[model samples]
Target: MKAKNDAPLRSRQLIGYFVFSILLNGFGNGLTVAMNLGSALWTASAVNLAHALHLTLLTVLLAEGVAVVLFNALVLRRLEWRRIAGNFIFMIPFSFLVSWFAQLIGMTPLVALPLMWRVVLDLFGIVCTGVAVSIYQRLNVMLHPNDDLMQILRFHFLHGNAALAQPLSFVPPITLILICVLATRQAYALNIGTLFSLVAQGAIVGLADRVVFPQLKHRHLVV
Candidate 1:
């Protein structure tokens, strides 16, 4: 039903949406830092390694990015250079927003607040992360290499069955979490935020589909 020439315009629109989603993801990351706890699974693993190896968090994150690219290339049996480039490009804005938001909207003022307040902040982060990820998934456009690999595995190997896709997608991050937990012997290697992110992924996506996406459509923010 779509015209052929619409492809280019649609592609550009998807790219724009993807960029916006990544920025929200970055804000979510900053909020996680503000919570003074471990972030989502992948980031928690990276943080664990950063502390143990005495390396900068960004350096370890870049290593993880490269590993993801290699894994995607292997699984898909093709080198998507655009995905490779996207990893680099997304990291730039992601890292910047994380740092900027951490300072601008940090939890510093809430140091004296109760645990419930911090929990509220973390929940907000979860919402941001959940909505951003949901939008990204719905767009069915370009993704970071790590996410692309997960989607590929979900679609190709799992036949797009969400039950299979969900558990299987956790493999990489869980592996990283275990490795860090065993290496560091930290009881909190996987903190509440990370665990919640994993468990609530489905709910979050559903919320976005039912609630957030409609708002975007009504506002003509995404097409």
Candidate 2:
């Protein structure tokens, strides 16, 4: 029965997973941001930068994306245009979705909810992020530049240990966040949720890989 699925079907499944990731990732980020509990480290860095620099979230995100893409070239020790384009392509819809979801969800009354429920939402957001990341990272049809950087570090430097690569990959963004915090004299998103993401996102993705869309194997070639 499983063999009934063919190449085109698999292609569609990948596409479907890609779209689902974009939505889930966007919604998850929105929830985290609106909760003001915390966000994934990279995202928290972007959000803090945006607030400090008085720029839009999309602007900071794109700038960070480009920087990561270039840094990826440095890691690979060469340039790859297709991979760069794929990163940008994923950013477009993803950025818009995140902004929209944030605005929509932020306007709701959940902010007045109890601390317990807010914590639940924050954790759920983090899990959503981990799961979405698992989907696209496995699909490997394309990836967020930051995730690509993790892949580069994981396979190329860290001996394929995603657990180590995950936090290790945070060095750059974490540095940026530190600078932003000092310059701005405040931090917006660095709480339990961010801590969870920093430590456990890789594990969550690993878990999701064996569970969510279990049939989807990692297409771990170049792009």
Candidate 3:
């Protein structure tokens, strides 16, 4: 009789674990957008090209999400060579698509402005999202599917190298740059906005890591 009661309690505990993970991941994603909202809005207001930048960011995010889903279903499930290859391959086109859409959107009169400004905006967005994901993962909460896959791959290929963690940590931003370049043919240029955005995103990510995640950790510990 006690065993039967304990079984439900254990199941409930597992369910709670899943719920906490989803909530933490979702909150991290939401905070990332909030952190970058200023740059996005400023770009839209100050530059004619901001709208395209906005659309481009949205598209790339969507593409990344799709890639994550497809990889999980087709590759991760099978745990085959194709999964790793497909994941990396899809990322390249996804990057290109992001830049292409940003350019295409920038061409519209509504937000058509300088190409350089749009590039800065895109870079800022990428850096913020990457930082946010990293901090959120450190909370030891549920992970984004992509993050989980990367960790798994890291274990297999790198033999659990601790340094591999940081490399995987930086992969998102690197991929973002590749995507930005694929979409935009212009030479990379550094500007005030680019620097500021990177700093701002880093700051926000740091605060979230230092402040918010600790509280979350405590809550789980108490529970």
Candidate 4:
């Protein structure tokens, strides 16, 4: 009789885990798609300096994403602050190389759009990414290596005060935005779009970490 009761509880736990995992992944996929699309659009639109900046951003983001995946899969295995910082430092050159390539490709400015529209899009993307991270963390699953690093920084350096960490977290994205703004007078038109795209991408990646790749060890246990 005790065994029978335990069986149902185990089944329920399994079902709950699976459901959360699916939700996390689904949200991640959506964010990824949105951010990639936004980046592509910005890259294809910006001219000369603006274009160069866009490409640089893309290259850096891609390098960071790849590095995070590898670090998580191989080196860190579990969250470690030094390992995360090392990963970031290692990827810096890749970011520079990508920027150089963008220059070689000869970037051009994008067609002008309303300033408000740009701002709206950018804000949307940023908000989405933040929300995604929150959701995934709440799921209590493993995070992508890059995110793990960010979380580590937030916890250790900022003493787990999200409010304090939040501003610091925006440093990279904000720097990129500033670069874009300074590169072209017309960049004002793209502020919103750029912000939204980045945030949305973050959110999506967070979701993926939770839902798509949820607690693989637990699943293995069940099997």
Candidate No. with top lDDT: 2
Per-model TM values vs. the true structure:
0.78, 0.92, 0.39, 0.40
Candidate 2 segments whose C-alpha is farther than 4 A from its true place: 1-9
| TM-score winner | 2
lDDT of 2 at 205: 76
Task: Give the alpha carbon lDDT tens digit for every residue of 135-164 in model 4.
Answer: 434333344344444554554465445444
Off by over 4 Å in 1: 1-16, 103-107, 161-167, 187-189, 214-223
Q: Candidate 3 residues 26-48, lDDT tens each?
A: 33333223233233211222122
User: Which is the better candidate, 1 or 4, if ranked by lDDT?
Assistant: 1
Which of the two candidates, 1 or 2, achieves a greater TM-score against the reference? Answer: 2
Candidate order by TM-score, decreasing, is 2, 1, 4, 3
Better model by lDDT, 1 or 2? 2
Give me the runs in candidate 3 sitting further than 4 Å from their true place.
1-9, 37-60, 69-143, 169-173, 181-223
Against the unseen true structure, what C-alpha lDDT does each candidate score? 0.64, 0.84, 0.41, 0.41
Residue 46, candidate 1: alpha-carbon lDDT: 66
Per residue, candidate 1 scores C-alpha lDDT tens digits across 45-133 of 66677776778666766787778778878887778676678666765556556656655666467545688887777767866876786
Q: Which pairs clash (backbone N, Cα, C closer than 3 Å) in model 3?
A: 48-111, 48-112, 49-111, 95-179, 99-183, 100-183
